[model samples]
Target: DIQKKKQGTFLPKEARIQPAAFSMAQVAKKPLPKAPAVSIQEEEEEEFKISTGMEPGKTYTGQKLDLDLQDIDLDNVFRLIAEVSNLNIIVSEKVKGKVTMRLKEVPWDQALDLILSTHKLGMIQQGNVVRIAPLKDLLDEEKERKRVKQERLQAKIEAAKRLQEAEIEAQERERKLRPFVTEFITLNYTKAKDFQAQIKDILTKEPKLERVGTAVVDERTNTVTITDYPEKIERIKQYKEKVDKPTPQVLIEARIVKATKNFARELGVQWGAQYAEYDKRGEWAWGVSSATGSGTTPPVTPSSWQSGSFTQGTGRDFFPLSGWMVNLPATLLPTPPGIGLQVGRLVGDLINLDLRLSAAEREGLTKIISRPKVMTLDNVEATIKQGREIPFTQVNPEGNVSVVYKEASLKTTVTPQISPDGRVRLKLDVTDDFPDRSNANPITGNPEIVKRQGTTEVLVRDGETVVIGGVLEETRATAEDGVPWLKDLPGLNWFFERKTRRHDQTELLIFVTPFIVQQD
Candidate 1:
């Protein structure tokens, strides 16, 4: 066992080997070669090529350079030149495009000039910094600078002339006012308190008058006394004469007109028109018109009139209407989004409902009354547009499609302009969109909307009414009068299914008027 253990523990010579000691003879060093001398020009050119351009803040020595760049980027040229000149050159945002130049050993300044000239650019130098901008901008700046200089010179000359004139005026005023300065003067004037401040202001502002003492007034006799230069005294006398003149009275009469009727008597009867005092200036009168329709017009009802008033002065007035009358069917009401509905006399004599609902409420009511597959009157919407377009999206079985809003909003645009002769010029634009049920089929969703637009420019006098009419709309309503299954029978369909047909014709009328109110 011992002999086997000793053989197993034997060490190899290579495994126990040590590293050899260091020797200078084993390592050899080589000498570095000297670089060739380069000219300043050549060194700069080499640096320009390597660096492409100069940094904005870095400075360089002014050195001559020979560059012959063709079809090279202008930005690269600016950078190379910047590096050679050792200048902080900044290119403005206005500078664009490339530049090509061919030059022989040129000074930095000369090269910069040539480049700027070729590009229609100008350079501004401040200390060691340089900025390049459009040539026109620099020229404009120069013109403005010259203009300012000329103005300054002219202002100085004017100021000197004014000072001389003031001095001369003072001497003349002193000579003329010396005699009256010691004399006491009294004048009779009404409203002495109102004139006292004015008289003192006139005396104080007159530099040449040489006035002394403030004005003294006696309210009992309406007399004012003052001691001042003779010129100031004469001026006060002239002022007193002017103030003593009688003030003219002005009376303003305001007339309220029903505007619907041509006679002024009708206005008095409708609104109990009477002159109501407004301060001391004038009077204002207002009246109301009789109601012809219960918010909805008959298919052929007479047009209602607008209310207005007139005064003998220039003023602005507003004529607002709650809503217009339309004879369209209840089912065909154009209850588009953001619209208000006032239900009155439903389609035909069968339904006589007078209710007002918003667009959303009308839609809900339609769902309860109409079949899901059938298109009801609510399916049709009336739209109005005035010099503007509204867009909407329509979804079909295939996909969602975008469509421009062609429906008239039933709204009108009214602009009033006044002329020198007291005549009012009005510009009116009215637009309406109604559904065309004739093209609507059970298969298709709905037919396209019928569009109506009207515009007119008219001239009228204040309190005169302008009525715009000739707009006609027709709508149809059909109701089934038989049982569901029996109406669909093949042989007896006509007898079992009877459709009650009704046709409605409606018209829209617009009334506009201008009134003049007295200004305070």
Candidate 2:
């Protein structure tokens, strides 16, 4: 068994001894120490380095060793190493184990490390003295050292934080004792009363000025009076400068257009041929005498009629003797001065006949444009209107007639917000009102009111126009004035009737444009 020693024995510095060989006879003379029973718990793997007492980057130049030993006392191996290296060695009582190693021409330090590793041992060197111990004890000692170092570092950081807070508190106390200075700040673009509460809130939140600082506004002079330390007053002034600048303005231009289109066609053919038979006296007579019978003809005449054929021979003008005849043009005649085609034909020779035809057509277009422009500050609303008010008569239950006026006008309301990048956002409400006299109230004789409204929001670039349209109205009508059965006839309808066809269309379109107004 290895004996416990009070102090580590040192070899003389000049005595660099090396044993040629180690035999079992020499090793067996000393009884091997019993291996300590170590219980190692599972832990997270960590990287650690032992202090070897050697300066950084230094190489070991000790003598090489060749050894073949079995069941050798571990403590005795360390003593042999200390003699060869001429260094003091201390071995822990817990470092008790038997080492069996075969090392060939290895450095003395490496031989010691191999034997220590085979027996689960570790070492730390101080100068030329080396101490050996169980690996588990060495690891526990290293962990405790790191933990203590961390605790000390944390304590130092906390102390520094407390010292800094104390310094801040002291500064705050000193600032609270300073004299208060009252300063007046005159605002150019913004009102002083608008910022009074905001400034007071800022000062009240500050630790040093919470109790003493005050902000008051004088509306007449447009100035804010601040009672605080000089530095704090300057800070408040800087903050005011940021938010009290000028607000931008936007000009909104809107155009409302109402277009009306009307188309009408009046086709009428008023054609008639009259037949009269004359007696030998050569005077016109309304009666036609046939060999079988004769009678007075009815006064009403057909719109399209033909009778008494006229024969135009060479240099000979012949009138009808047995039948009524008249000459009628095949094509449409030229229109008359007023409205429709008027054709009148007369054939002479004891026969008086007249033919008249009429036709008319018309087309018209009308456009009414209203331009309204309004300017307002950013995020403000503006309105423009142009129109009249109509009065309506109302009778209450007491039979009293009272007149109430209602607005019939074109109105536009817009709210514009100016973006930082020179774009405009618009909220629009447009209304158009008019009186419809075609459908009047029967009891009151008051015209009906027609209203058109639209509301929308849009984003547009500056100086750009946007158009909105979809209000449309259309009407179609046809009228006929003739005998009911005759007007519907296929081939002869045009000659027997007057037909009128009308088409009307109306549309409303709005164009909006925005311009950023630059202030001087």
Number of the top-ranking candidate, with lDDT as the measure: 2
Q: Write the per-residue lDDT of candidate 2 for residues 1-520, one digit (tens) a residue.
A: 3333223443233222334474323433443343333233212233346643333564656667776656667776787676566667779998777766766666787677667666777776655656688778888988896897688789999999999999998988877666788988998888888878667756644643555678888999999898877788888888888988888988887655554421110111112232232323433222211111223322222121212322222221112233323222122112110111112111221111111111111122324356778888898888867789989989999999999999998776788888666767777676667777667899998888877565655555677554444344456789879877887899998878987999866544455677899988
Candidate 2 at residue 301, lDDT? 20
lDDT of 1 by residue, 219-315 (tens): 7766677666667777887888877543321111111111112111111111121111111243323222222322323232122223323333323
lDDT of 1 at 187: 43
Off by over 4 Å in 1: 1-407, 435-450, 484-496
Q: Predicted candidate 2: what Cα RMSD to the true structure?
A: 26.1
Distance (Å) between predicted and true CA of 310, model 1? 27
Which lDDT value does model 2 have at 381? 89
